[model samples]
Structures are given as C-alpha cells and as structure tokens.
Target chain A: MTTATTTDLYPTRGTAEVLTPRQDPVVWGAPGTTGPLRPSELGDFDRDGFLPVDALIGPEDVARYHAELERLCADPAVRADERSIVEAKSRDIRSVFEVHKISPVFAELVRDPRVVDRARQILGSDVYVHQSRINVKPGFGASGFYWHSDFETWHAEDGLPRMRAVSVSIALTENHDTNGGLMIMPGSHRTFLGCAGATPEDNYKKSLQMQDAGTPSHTALTELAGRHGIRLFTGQPGSAVWFDCNCMHGSGDNITPYPRSNVFIVFNSVENAAVEPFAAPVRRPEFIGARDFTPVR
Target chain B: MTTATTTDLYPTRGTAEVLTPRQDPVVWGAPGTTGPLRPSELGDFDRDGFLPVDALIGPEDVARYHAELERLCADPAVRADERSIVEAKSRDIRSVFEVHKISPVFAELVRDPRVVDRARQILGSDVYVHQSRINVKPGFGASGFYWHSDFETWHAEDGLPRMRAVSVSIALTENHDTNGGLMIMPGSHRTFLGCAGATPEDNYKKSLQMQDAGTPSHTALTELAGRHGIRLFTGQPGSAVWFDCNCMHGSGDNITPYPRSNVFIVFNSVENAAVEPFAAPVRRPEFIGARDFTPVR
Candidate 1:
C-alpha cells in the first residue's frame, strides 16, 4: 500500500487540499488545423474551458433522441441492466449508461460529425468513448449532483491518466432555468482539486447513484465558485455544451413540471488509454468507464 | 491463462457436462457431538441434503421481522443502496443484501442459537456469513429463478474452496403452494454440476437480479430432476429450511395475491475462506459474497 501511494500522481483523500496544476493543454489544436470550429470559437473554449454550441443538432434529431430516451426507459431489459441507474426517490430512470452499446441510435449519434468532429478538434487525436449515457432529470423528486470535477473521478477511479477528454451534453428537452440543468464553473478547469476521503470498496456501486467520495470539499467548492463564477446552461432542445473533463460542474433538482434530459457523451483521446486507478482500490466496470479504447472511425 | 486453467479444480463453461464428485462432507459432524440436532435429524439431512424446522421463531419474532422488512422496503435510502436490487418489470425491491449489516434486527437474528448452531453443527466448525439477504417476491409480476446450485456460483465467482457452507431461509410470509416457493432436488448435493458458458464480466451485477451465465444447462437440470426428484417447500411464516450449498434449488414467480419473503442467510466454515475466482475474471462484491472470514460468535 505504501509503495502504491508513493508513485501516485494525483493523490486524493488527504487531510488538506492538494490542487495539482493542469499539465495538459485545454485545446490540443489551434486555428485552422482543427475539425470544424472557427478560430474565434476555439479561442473562447481555450479561455473559458467550455463552449456552448447554439445548434448542435436540428429539431428533428432532438425529437428522435427524445423518443429513443422514452423507449429505453420503458424497456424492462434496460431497467433490469445494472447500467441503468434509477432515481433515488422515484421509479424514474436517472441515467442509462453505455448508451452507445445499448442502442444503435445512440451508437450512430456518437459517430456523427457534429459530435465526433468537435471532440477530435479539441483533443487533437482520434478519440474513443470513455463513457456515454442519457442523464434524465424527471420533473418531480429528481436528485441533483454535488459540485465536483469529472476528471477527479475519472483519474482516481477510472484510471484516466490525463485531462484529455471532452464531455458533450446534447439537450433532449428544453433546459429551462427552473429545471435542473448543468452548472459549470468557468475557468476552473486549470486546477485539479484533490478530494479528502478514501473511496470505499466497490465505490462505483453507490457513487453512481449518489457520489460522496472524490467530491470537492465545502472549502474547495466555495473558493473555486468564488474565483470563477458558476454558469448555468439554459437553452432550447437542440443546443449542446462541450466542457473540459476537469471543469467543476453540478446541477440542482428539478422541482418544476418541465423535465430536463441530455445525451451525454465523453470522448477520450486514444493516446491516453486507461491504466490502474490512481487512488481507488479497483477500476470501475466497463459500462461506467470503458476499457475498450477502440478509436471511433 | 493456460497455467490458470491447469490449476482449476472445478472447471466450468465447456461444451460438455463436467459432474465433479463432492469432495467435502455434507454434514461434517457425527450425532451426539454436534451443536444442536439429533442423530436421526442429522442422518436425514445427510441423505436428503435439506431439513426443515417447523417453528424456527415465535409468532412475535415473525411479526417483528415482517415489520422490519416493510420498513426496509419503503426507506428511500435503502432503496437507493446498490445492494437493494429492484425487480425487472417494476420498481419493487426484489432483494436487499448484507442484511446482517443493514439492520440491527437482522444482526440479532443471525446470532440466534436456532440459526447459527445448526450451521456450526453441519459445517463442523466456527462459521461466518458468506451472504445474507431478504428476498422479497411480491405478488404480481415478480420474477422467478431458474434451477441452479448456489455452490456453482460461489465456487466460480466467490472462490470458495470447499462446499462446507449452509444456507438457512427463514420464511417471513406464509409460503403458499400457489405463490413462489423454493423447490429443491433431493440427494443432489453429492454431485457438483460444472455449468456451461463463460461467466460474463461483472456477472453478479446481472446475476443478482436475473442469472443467466454460470447456470446449469437444461439437459443437466432435466437429468438431475429425473433422478433425484423435486420437493417444494410450502410452510407457514417463521418456518426455516437448512440446505447444503451444493443443492439444486429454484423458485417460481409469485403470481398469487400473497407475497413470499424470506430472510436468507449463508454460513461458511471459517477454514473455507475465499480467494481469487476459480472460473470468473474477478470475485463478486462483498455485499453479495463476503470475503471477511471472521467467525460469528
């Protein structure tokens, strides 16, 4: 155990906070060499650690995705699969993981030029899905996520070595201000906030439903939110947000009648494949953090 | 991988059946020196592989357990727990595992002499909880389990070296003949049926809710049922049945209005602790199959 900890790069669950400086560049490619985004849009992504695309998919595509989401939720086999996480309070499906493998519709969605090209532009390499899911926030009794960076979990538990991943959340429903929508901290991706609690054995089992470990402490969240003001993403159904893996993000519970849902896809550069977890006792299951690093065509 | 297979004592998932003879004794102790049972009762258990206790607990204790089961099923936190497996077709709680640790009422129940003494007598040593669960087969759409032996899974996935384990299922509800009641093959404990098909990665995740892999083939089940014959357990609430780990058993779906619930506990000999899985890629989580070998006093 001592030897294992000695070589740790991003040590978490300590008495005090250890903010590791970001070693990798936010956007790997610059200007004309990138996939589709203009130089000005690339500049905004590099500066703010996120870029909101007003029209990622057309209205027809959004409707198709919404129908697919409903079908997946209603399917008994999908609910029976361990990958589908149910809401804590209600019978509604909270999230269905490994969506690409579960549905051909989602499998095709991941390969789309609008989704895959932007990821290739940001990471500057052929990418594979590290994770993909449909996060559903049903109208009543939907739970919220706490303030935490995705990279913290991916690194500590999924064995993701670098922050060379981008998460694309394409809205399936209108993300009203009142509905529980993603809230990310602008410019907070540069520093990795080392968390302060040992990850429990088989942590993924509980953490999927309610993440307690590898979360930012109250002090760390307060400092980061103060340094970089929070940004709540509210848009029409087809809008999408591409954010850095290390950005501090969370969401509120949807108490309103309107539901909020998205097709969340994470593309990790093939160059940075997963290894053994840096802090956790074991790597999570393939459905949560994929080990099959086959590059997307 | 070749070296690992050569060393495997009980190989599974091949094209043909591999009926390994039982190397361990079903009832380890002789008559008078055993923990609680008489000579005739011990002989019956050795022959039939199962013995039923008419009244394992009083009516008041049964009421207490019923109340506790109701409480656990309704609690949101318990439902949120990954240990609580939901039904395939509905949001109903199917089974809540690690019951000894989950509820104080259950913790006390395991230590009761009527339960633990018989386990010690049959195992002929100090015993520990290899697994404990409250299986709730609620009427209307609750699923049934196909025929399978518990030891096949314990040996393949949990890495238990020997078949020196006993499972006690104490009925919390009156198990009517129409409702789903446990059916076991008499004298089936002598042969260890090495199941066909490779145990899928993270099999417990799916197997807990509905097992597919690591199960005996239809041919094997047919032969066993033909030879040994089947016996269905239907009794009033508080009745308990003690069976060897290797016995082939399964239950039907509770289509009747009455519900069938049981506090199922498995006790393994302290000497027969777990190691790396013999057939599976990895051992199951501690909640489903415990690794801790601390003797229960």
Candidate 2:
C-alpha cells in the first residue's frame, strides 16, 4: 500500500517520532450503497493518471453549489484577493479560493459525501483538502489555460511532498465544444515535464509559452501528442474529472457565448502532506496555497 | 539561523529534490516603524519556551471579537458540530474551529497585523494558522485543566514535523486567580514528552489527566515540575500568551463569580507545515485538525 512517508533530505529533526500515527484505509458508504468504483471505472486513471466522474453532484446539488459559486465570485473581496483573476474583456471572475470559508453552501460542497467517499477509496484512508478553487471561463473570447501539469507547480511552488494527490473538477456549467474544454495527452503523467521559473503572475496566460530549455520543450510534448493521442474532457453540468497531479494538461480559449465554470478541489493523501515549497523565494498567499491539512470526515 | 528542516524518519522519498528553496527571514513590517523585537524581548521564548504579551488586541478590538465569539457560540450548527464543548454546570462554550471560515470578524482576527507580524519574526518566515479555538472557563467553579505540551498532541496525532509552532491566547475576559488561569512549567519544551494514545475527544478536559505508558509518566513530569517552577498566566482583557507547542502547560477550573474567555490560535512556520496524522486508523476531523497550511500575509 502506498503511504505518506517522511523524506530524509533535511538534517535537523530530533527523532523518528516525527512520523507517527499511520493512517488506515477508510471504507466508503454503507456496505451496498457504494463500496468502490469498478475496475473498469478506474482503468483510465490507472493507465492515463486521470478518470472521468459521472453524476457526482446530481442536478439539484449542482444547482445549489453553482449558485453558491456565483455568489462567492460576486463578492468584491474574492476578486480583490490575489487568488481571483479576470477574463480581461469580460471582466468576470476567473478563479477564487477558500470558497468553503465564505459561503455555508460552498462549505457543504466541500463535505459532500459523493466527493469525499470516492476520494477516500482512491487515495486510501482520510483525505484533506490541499487546495480549492473555481476556475471560471467567461465566454465570448474568455481565456483558456495552456499545457501544464499541476504537480510541477504544486511540488515546486507549494511543497506538496509527492504525487499522491488528485484534483476533482465539478463542472458548474456545461463544458462543451467552443467553450474550451480540458485536453490531456493519455499517459503523459509518466513523463516528468521539467518546468523553469515559477508560474508567472497568472496561470492561464503564462502557462502557454512559459517553458524553457530545461522545461517541457514543445518538441517533446508534440511527440507525446502524436504517439499517446490527446483526449478532450467535455461534459454536462455535475459531471467531474479526476486527474493525477502529474498529468500534463491544458485548454484553449473560449469564443462561445456560453460560460464554463468548474469548482476544482485538490485532495492529497493525509500521509503525503506538503512542506514548504522548493520552487522560489516568494510563495503564493494562503488564498492560493492552503495551510490547513485536517482530513474531511 | 535556526530553520525548519525535516524529520529523520520514513525512508522512501524518491529524490533529494524533495527538499528545496530554504525559507528566508520575512520582514515583519514597514522599515523602522516597529521592527523585530530585541533579543531581550524574546529571551523568555528562547530560554523558557514561552512569551507573554501585555496587550495585543486593544480594548475596542477585544470587545468586538468577544461579541463575535458569543454570537458564534449561539450558532446551532456550532453547538451541533463536534468541535464545540460545554463546561457542564456553566453550560458555556468551550471550543470551536473554522471560526475564520464562518465569521468575517473572526476571519479578520486571523489576519490581525499584530498576530501575523510577530509570528513571522519568530518562525523566521510567513506562517499559517494550524489550529484556532475559543477556550471558555466560566466562573463559579468552572473546570480547569492538567499539564501537557501541544506538540505532544500535534506530533503524535497531526504529523507535524517539528515544534516550530506557537499558540497565541488573547484573553477576552479578565483571567484572574479565582478564574483558574493557565499554569505552565517555565522551560519544559526543551524535552520531548512522547505520547501514545490519541489526544482525547476534547482538549480542555483530557489535557488535565491524560497520559499513559508510552507517553511521559506523571512521575517524570512531577520531577520536572519540582525543578522548573510552574507559573500562572493571569491577565486582563486584551492580554495574550505566546507559548511553544512543546511547552508543558494546562489551566485550572474557575470557581470565582467571574468568567474567562480567550481566543486561542496556533501558528506554525510555513516551511514546517503538517501532513495527515500517522498515529492510527481514525483521525481528528477537519474542524479539530485543519489541513490548509496557507501562510497568513
């Protein structure tokens, strides 16, 4: 069983007592309600480092959470806070953080049984929210993020210990053609796409042309695209995608009138918790890099 | 030059790249307005493992925060959630968490300049809130606590790497002798009081009489108590106490007619952030053991 272990890289710790109380695998739902996903369901994730989640929130819950997301995004502070970004032309909220901290409804979404129960099955034992945000693509030429893997930034910038983490993106609105849906190269996670310099101020713009000599060269990613094949993650509202942190992925700009908003949450194994980041001198604010590591019950 | 490094245990890290980008000493405030404290100011924290702040939150701010605390105590969900506890006879609120996630007022307190600046200086960089609670000791014979160190609970249960953490308790009401104020051993943090069982359901009580074989024995603690005299932390409204997470400490019951309420927050160095607990199968819920490690700016 893969577990969160300690790194011996640093030299000053006093004792082995530092790594105590190993976590136990948690059973999900009632015996029959939902044990775990079928092998077929996780096949893609096992091979490609990501999986698709269907009907996670259902219609009613999706509506509720979507409304909450909108309300939180409307809050001026969300935009003012460093975590929020705008789609220049549309002037709409592009991303927001600690939504669970602001709205009681969003807080409920963070604890939704549908999400929590499944996450436990995949990661084993209890899982704590490493990071939570709503990536909003305001339509009619709204921005789309370019190719990048989360772990590259997470490990380098946020200090996440290992790749024992995955992200769940619950589409608040339909993400279809013309709206710039997510795209990933099957099995690209196996390759370590080295990154250079910290992700520039904003993620969407900088990610596209940010690579350097040591980073993922366009030539290499192009080869993987031809060999492994690229897949599109387009779905209806309430549908979700769970991707490994190491998977190289990105999306194109949206020119459709329809907007695409998805609540993205990164869940890390309690065993694989993070330390201080190794990437740069300045770290992102709490709105960006979470500080609390308590597991969700 | 003391910095937060890694624990020596757990041997499976894949790379030396696991640890990178050492933490820098963050400047607390504008140049010269009020710089870091002098060596003498932190003499107690360095020598005795604790420091006392005479007036952190001003009377006006304390009044405001105290009002917010009472309002939250009345929240139905707050009472229903496992985090809140009552003193039995007094029926007063004992503890609560995610207060910053709920109330905007409490959220502001989480970012209070006074609390953040000093914590950064001591921690040597940006710091994040590890745990936050309101401990209430209602008068007329309200309950008091026994002795124990925070790191004992944090390390054994929460997987914190080092004791690079501190607790700030700001008195909302006057903490007097009759009210069963906090009592702590002067320099107990230097020694590690290993614990076995998980920290009990509630901190206010179990802390008073909790410990077993694998943990530090009472007989051993008694000897230390004799050598290092215990000091009572009693003060007026707005006064605060900053103590090392490893310091042996606890408080007493309040038999007086007066009541004592305080806002207690735990701050850990960003570089020394935590992972999921390692102690056992089940773990503390998000309310009790937070997972977010975002440093407060």
Candidate 3:
C-alpha cells in the first residue's frame, strides 16, 4: 500500500482539511462523474500544455445570450461616465452580472460534468472559481490588443495550485473563420510566451519582428494554420470551447456585420491555494439562486 | 496629413472604438498618447515582456477587502454543498463583486487613477478586464503548482493577445521571503521558447546538479533577480508587481500560520482585434456600480 509520507514525490498536506472540496462527482465520489482523463488527453496536456474540450455549450443558449447582450447594449442604463470610462469611445459596460444573472445555460456550461471531472483528475482538490465574464464585441476598428499571458499577472511564490486552470468560452453566435472566430497557435502555447504584457515595440525589439509583419513566411505553424489543419473553432450558438488558461488564442475580426459575443469562465483548484480577486468588483443579484456558494479566501 | 492610411500601426477595432470617443481628450490626443513609451518601463516590459504597476489596491482598501473576505469565509450560510464542493477541506468562494459594491474602499482600489494611467501608457486605449479574484492559500500540503506560463493553456500562436495582456497583483499583506513571496525567473520572458512549460518530470530529468531536488529553477533570468542590482520586489501591502504573463514564475510553501492573500487583475485592449479570456472570472462590482461607463472595446 502506498502509505502517505511527507517526503513522498507528491507531498500533499496530508490532512483532509488541506483537500479542496470536489466540484465534479466524476472525479470524486459523487455519482455520474466520468472516468479519469484519457491518456490522449493527458498526453496532449503534457506535450502542448493544454487541450480543447469541444461542444461544451450548444446553439440555443448562444442565441439567447446574444439577444440578452443586445438588450444590455441598448439599455441607456449602461452608459460610460468620466471616472469609470477607461477608453475614448469605449462605453464601459461595467458589470454584466449585475444587470443579468448568468443564464441557466451559462451556469450549465460552467457546471459541466465532463469539465469538472477532468479538472478534478488534474487539479486535485482546492479547485475554485478564478473568474467569469461576458465580452461583446461590436463592429468598429479598434486597435488590436497585444498578446500576453494570464499567469504573469498573479505572480506568487507560495500556494499556487497545481495543474492547468481551465478557461471555458461559450460562443453565443455562429463564429466563422472570416467573421472573427477564435484562432490559436496550436503548440505555441507550450512554446511561445505569446506576448503577455509586453508592448508591441518591445516585442518587436525582442523577437526582431514587427507586429503587422505577420508570422515569418517560413514558420511551420503559420503555414499550418494557413494551409493544412488550422483548427478554427467556429461554433454554433451555445457551443462552448474549454481550454487551459495558458492556451494561446486570439479572435478574428468581426468582418461581418453581426456582433461577435461570448461568455467566459475560468476555474482552479482551491486546496493549498492563495488566490485574490484579480479585477474590479461587479454586482450579483441575491435571488438565492445558486445557494451554498463559498467565499473568496 | 497623417491620415489613417499613413499610420503604419493602428489600434484594434475595440481600442479604436474606445479612442474614437476620446480622440479630442488632450491626454490621449496627439503627442501625449502618440509618443513612444518610457525607456525603463519599456525595457522592463521588453526584457520580462511586462511590468508591475504599484498600489493597485491601496493599503486601507486591502485591509477592508481582507475583513470582508474573512466575513464571507466565516459565514455559515456560504458553506460548500455536495455539487459545488471541490476539495473536502478547502472551500471555494464566488461573486466577490457583491461585497465590493458596498465597500467604497474597494471601488477606489479598482479604479486607482495612477494604475489605470500607467496601464494606458503601456497598453494603449481601453483595457479589457480579463479577470479579478482574491486567492487565499490555507496551509495544505499540496505540491506547489507546476511551473508554467499562463498562455500555455490557450493556443500556441506567437502573435495572439496572450502576448499583450498585463497582469497586476496588489499585495494585501507583507509577503516576506520566508512566507513565500513570489519568485520569478527575471528576463525569462524574452527567451525564444526556452525550457518553459516543460513537464516537472522532464524538468527533474534536466535539473541542475547545484539545485535542490524537486525545486524548479528557471534558466534565463534566474541569476538576474539577485545579481547586478536587480531587485526582487518583496511585495508589501499597497505595492503591486506586474510582469509578462509569459515570465517564468511559481510559488513556495506557506509555512506560516496565517494565509497569504493578494488582489490580482489582468487587462488587455479590446479593439478591432479579439482574444479569448484566459482565466476564470471573479466578480467586478465596480463595473456593475459605475453607470454611463463606456465598455472599453
């Protein structure tokens, strides 16, 4: 029997108190939970550091979210003020959670059994919600955001959770390769740093390449995304794509007239963890809807 | 005349939208916003691919957030349930924006003018709130989280916004060397896909003889943080640290009795370009409270 030892390769906190509550029944003792992550998934995660779990959300939900988003955008209540306004033409759509509670579809997407189970198998206890939000992109020429990473922000020396924290994006519209669908760099997430927090000039200097210069015509991955199997996740409404938070991804332009919308949520284990809120606060209606929620540590 | 066509580099659609409304504002108009970024800040960002802005959360605000966190943790009504629980002993928290709305202190911290201005300087136009959350690590014996970049979980594209996003962490308490302050591989962010996101087992197989077993060490900037006057920000309450999301970073054990806490936020410009959310979402009450705020494209 593998006796629990402090010096074991996987040195755990030993006490049950140190363990995080299991959110997915599949990994824990809860019934109807799935089996352990497949070797293929593990191998992908190990080699690429992430994998995309498909069909997380469906089409019907996407339509609903888009409609609700349109309503929110039209509402005069969601105006940008001086203090809250961070951009020139950007109308601050403060907190969507206040104006709208997560649709049941959104909540279902978050509480997906397969995802929770997979997280449990990889992360092991102490899993917690890192953040969730809805980003609605309207038509207009905005300067493209620079590339960057999520982990670079919350730098910590102790109490960081093991395994990849999962970030799930639910498309509320039919995203196509041309109409601002999500694009990724395949294995680049495990290789390239993806310009987290650096300026374009700095990136140019460091990489010796200009931002618009485009990936070198010689690069294999660029060629692959361009010619061969460049996987573009153009999902129907409500179709969700779940990936590791560190994955390298960017959105295509809304070249089409329709607005591109999506809801995102990230989750991490809570055990032996030290996490703080990373953004400004938003309001949540107290409908006793989602009961027994834990507080941020 | 410097028409749009003449400008080689332009802002993203989201960024452009944000800037469109403020094109007349002196701060963002002409020379002020058009000039190149500061050398040192740019260097820091270039070398590490990111920089940390200070006082992301004021000292007093940190104190209040701590208090509210304590109340939420202690509240019996917020206990984890069967489905939601992840770790048995560790409890997960959610929806902090609700509490933040009531506390003017947190509002001020989130909208800290200085931090926002710096962010604008670094990442032009409107900054999108990628995520926000407070993490508390109770002394659990879980192995320290693996060493990896945040963007590794997403796609592998080299030019994705994962490269441009900046994360800011406001230390709520004094993080000492012993108590597990953040450890970073200085300048590691600039390496050409060096040994980052490597498996722990692979890293172990390649560990340096002089290094301690199982303790991960980065190669690029390891020696720089301590040598040549390179300072490690042993972050104190009210002080914030920012770095490239791709910068090599990890945490140590929280051997102390008290928990480690901090407020972290990731920002990106939303313009004509699009990128998926990398991490989980924590609530932003300030976004909900501030009406008439323009949504940063």
Candidate 4:
C-alpha cells in the first residue's frame, strides 16, 4: 500500500466542502470525517429509505454547476470519449458520465455537504462516489428510462459488496412530468429485489466481452407498480433527493420543449466499496470509480 | 357494419361483472355506463396524474383476486403463451401478462368500481382495458423493471391516438421494497414524454423492419430523478394506485423470501381507443390488446 503523504493526502475532485482536506489522511470510521444527523431526519430515512433536502443548496452554486455542465458538454474534446457522452433517440446530448474526473466544477459538486453529510449519516461512515454523472434531457425528444434498480447494475456490473450506498440527485432545472422527471417507490430499501439483465463476467475487458443488460419486460413493470403504488418527485432548481441504492426507481422521457438536467452522485461506503467487476484482481478504471479508500470529511 | 346482437353484444371476457350480459346492446358513452367522481378527487386527478382509493376494495375481493392470480399463473394453458410468461436472471416467474382475457376474476378486476369510476371521470367517457396484466415478483429471484413511459409503446406500436388513458395497479398483497414495489414521478401526466423501446412496425413482418427504441440511459434517469424526485407506493392488500398512462415508472427485484403480487389494468377511453398499429390495416394480436371496441360499464 502507498503511504499517505501531505502532497498526495486528499485525492479531491475540487474544493467542495463535502470533501474537506484533512491534516492527515484517514480511513473510514475515523474521527472528524463525519457529522451527526438530526434525530427526526434519521428516523424518516431509516423508515422511508429516502429523504429530501429542500433548497439546501444556494442559487449561486446551482447556477455555477448548471453553466459548467453546459460548457463541458459543448466542448468537442469532452465528447471524444464514447463512454463520457451518451445520446438520446433524437440524438441530443443526454448525459455526461464520470464528470468528476474531467471538470473541477463537477468534482466539487460531488463533495457538496448537502449530499455528503446525509450520505454519511445513512451509511454511518465515510463514503466515495462510485459513479458520478450529469443527466441532460435537453428540449424535445430526450428519451426516458425503463424501470430497474441501481444495485442491479452495481452488483451485476461492478461487484459492489452490499446495498450500503446511497444516491444523491441534484436538480439543475424544474423537474416536472414534461421534462422527464423521476418516479420512486418509497421505503423500498428494506429489501434487495432480483432483476433481469445481462451478466457478463468480463464486461470491463478491453474488448468489452459482455452484452448489455436488457430492460425489464412490460409484464414485470405492470405487476410491481400494482402492489407498490408509485410517486413522483418535482422540486425547484436547487432541491436534492437522497435515495437508497436498493430502491427501485426510473424516469420518463422529456418530450416537452423545455430542458431537464441534474447531477447524480452514487456514494458507496468505503467499507462496502466494490473491487473490480466479476471478481477480477485488478481495480476498476478510475473514470468508473477509484480504489482510493480515504474518508472524505 | 353488423348490428349488435344480444348474444355477442359485449365481446366479453369470461363472465366478469363489468361485462355482464345486457338484453340490449348499447354503444359506448351511453349514460349509466359511467359513475361520477367527487369534485375534490377530480381536481386531484387533474393536478396529479394519479390518485389512490384506499381500502376501496374489500378484503374478500382482494383475497379472491389474489387466489385467482395464483391459480391462473400455474395453469399450463395460461402459461403456454410465450408473451404471458416472463423470466428473470434467476429464472423465477416475473409476470403474468394479459390476465383479464384468461381469468374470470381478473376480468372482473377490469371493472372494479373503485378503478372505473375515477377513470371515467378523468376520461370523461366510457373506457376499456386495452391491456391488463398481473406483475408477479414472487419471493426469491423475482425480477424488476427498467424506467420507461408506457405511452411510448402504445403510440409507436399500437397506433394509440392520445394519452387519454390510465393504469390501475391493484395490490393483492402488501407491496414493499423487497417485493419490487411500484415507483413513480408525481404529476408526470401533464405532458407526453418521448421514449426508447421496440418499434414494432417492422417487427410484425419478421424483417426486423424497425429499430427498437433505446432503453433509458443511466444519465437520463439521474437527471429526471434529481429534478422531480421519486416516491413509492406501499399499501395493504386491496388498495389501488390509479396512474396516468404517460407517467414514467418501474420497479425493483425481490431477493427476499416474500412474494409481491398485483393486478394491473390499463383503461383507454372509447373515443381514444387505438387503431391498427403503425396505421397497418390488420390489427395487433389479441394477447397484446383487443380490437373489440364494445365499451365496458
């Protein structure tokens, strides 16, 4: 293992308050890396598997991040990597994955206190964003998603150890039905549901030796919705949603003339961080996730 | 056109109460075929894409329907249809599609007053179960679905005219996270969202004529969920969630040892009933949907 020196102590994406640099590097569960949660919020989170921090982020930060998203997406150099830039049915820019590795603004967004404090409270330890992305459903014809769970992807694709992580979705626009908003089943974190999808043992191989996971069938969606009942989350520009990784969730298409955008950061407990996919000995790519296990204050 | 005969007036599905034989054949939109909704409920339905009728169904009805779901799924005849029986990675039963056409109990579920009454109020006319199914995420290995908008399928494949329809998810048992509960983005009914999925115009010809609509990418889901947030529906047996046809939704897999079962019914306004898919002269198969336009009260 490499020694933690002052020069290379904090592998921070940027100067976001969520990842404050410590005088000394520490592993998870170390002191000064976390804060206490409000009793009521913790209770609700434990019971509901989700919580909302309404308007916790300031307007300036939201504007800055939104601008940065647009700037990065427009840069041709950023779009060179197929994995970083994804397209919708209309061929519009849909999402920018792994932005924390390329842009300081996005890196800072990952470490925001509004997200980290709650995540730590949920995981009860230090955390890192295993996956970070910005979903941009711009104007009309931005495609919607089918129903599936994130753990299904994390466990099947990344070999994540457990369902101990949380996902934070930070809204950059008015999230409404017309703009491809999110829908979730509450209290869904209590259990891990099985799934239907491709399971390639060597997906991350240089040759991409695995097939992609197929979407859940229509019959499966119809049945789950019947028993659980579904709900939507429409918040103003600066609100944030904290959800359990095991919760079953999905979103609609943005066929409206308006645009919908947000930054999504998936935080896994350092204790529960995944190794390489399919039991591989080497670590996964840094763009997907890093092997650095230092706790972020 | 052939005159409506008393013997075959309804083109009924079994002997369900909703399709009770009538001495005289009445056209769709006739009075007495639909009931009124409370003004408050109507307002809520207009504002929010969905509304829940809590305990509207009695315990006896719930039990009866649940039992029928189990009985029908196990029968070889019902499972014979490849489209009806779906499997997950774990190879357990995931869903039972087109239930209304196969079982009397499910046929009655199509016209459950709790569902039809409000549906007519929202639709402002008679309605029909264009599609009905039972999503069976049974205990271990029950698969979940990906996020998607249902109208994307209907409009592109079934020649549906508009979004003048609703889906009722009737809980046959307790719907929780472990069992792959239904989740939604609230108020997603305000506008029609574009989607990525199989476009079947060419599918019917065996030439692979049309490209399948792409699945919602990871970025798209993250953006929408951030803006709108998401919520789950967990209710006791017999409670139902009535949702807009265009809502973005999906569910989780059930790894737990508990089964999550529910019947799903999609009601389309008689005036808004679909024509042949993609403007084709021939109709889609019955197992997919019905061409019988006889209205149900």
What TM-score fits each model?
Answer: 0.50, 0.43, 0.34, 0.53
User: Quality of candidate 2's docking, in CAPRI categories?
Assistant: incorrect
Ranking by lDDT: 1, 2, 4, 3
The candidate scoring highest on DockQ is: 4
Model 2 C-alpha lDDT per residue in residues B1-297, reported as the tens digit of each score: 899655533211122212121122222223333434556656657678778889988999999999998888888988886677666555667767667776788878878888877777676667888888887676434555546667766755666766677788899998754345777788776666554343344442343232331244445555666667667677889999888777776654443345789988888888777775544334456665667887786
Error of 2 at B127 (Å): 0.9
Off by over 4 Å in 2: A1-297, B1-36, B88-91, B196-215
TM-score of chain A of 4: 0.78
Between prediction 1 and prediction 4, the one with superior DockQ is: 4
- Interface DockQ per candidate: 0.01, 0.01, 0.01, 0.06
Badly placed stretches (over 4 Å) of model 4 are A1-52, A81-101, A107-170, A173-236, A240-279, A287-297, B1-52, B82-101, B107-169, B173-236, B241-278, B286-297
iRMS, all models: 22.1, 30.7, 20.5, 11.5
Per-model CA lDDT versus the true structure: 0.85, 0.65, 0.41, 0.62
Could you report the Cα RMSD, in angstroms, for every candidate shown? 20.8, 28.6, 25.9, 11.7
lDDT of 4 by residue, A230-282 (tens): 66677888888888776667665443445888988888888777754432334
Best prediction by lDDT: 1
Evaluate model 3: give its TM-score. Answer: 0.34
Q: Which candidate ranks first by TM-score, i.e. highest?
A: 4
**Candidate 4 lDDT tens digits, B115-209:** 77767767778888788888777753454555666665565456666667778888888875335677676655443444433344444333111
Query: Which candidate model has the greater TM-score, 1 or 3?
Result: 1
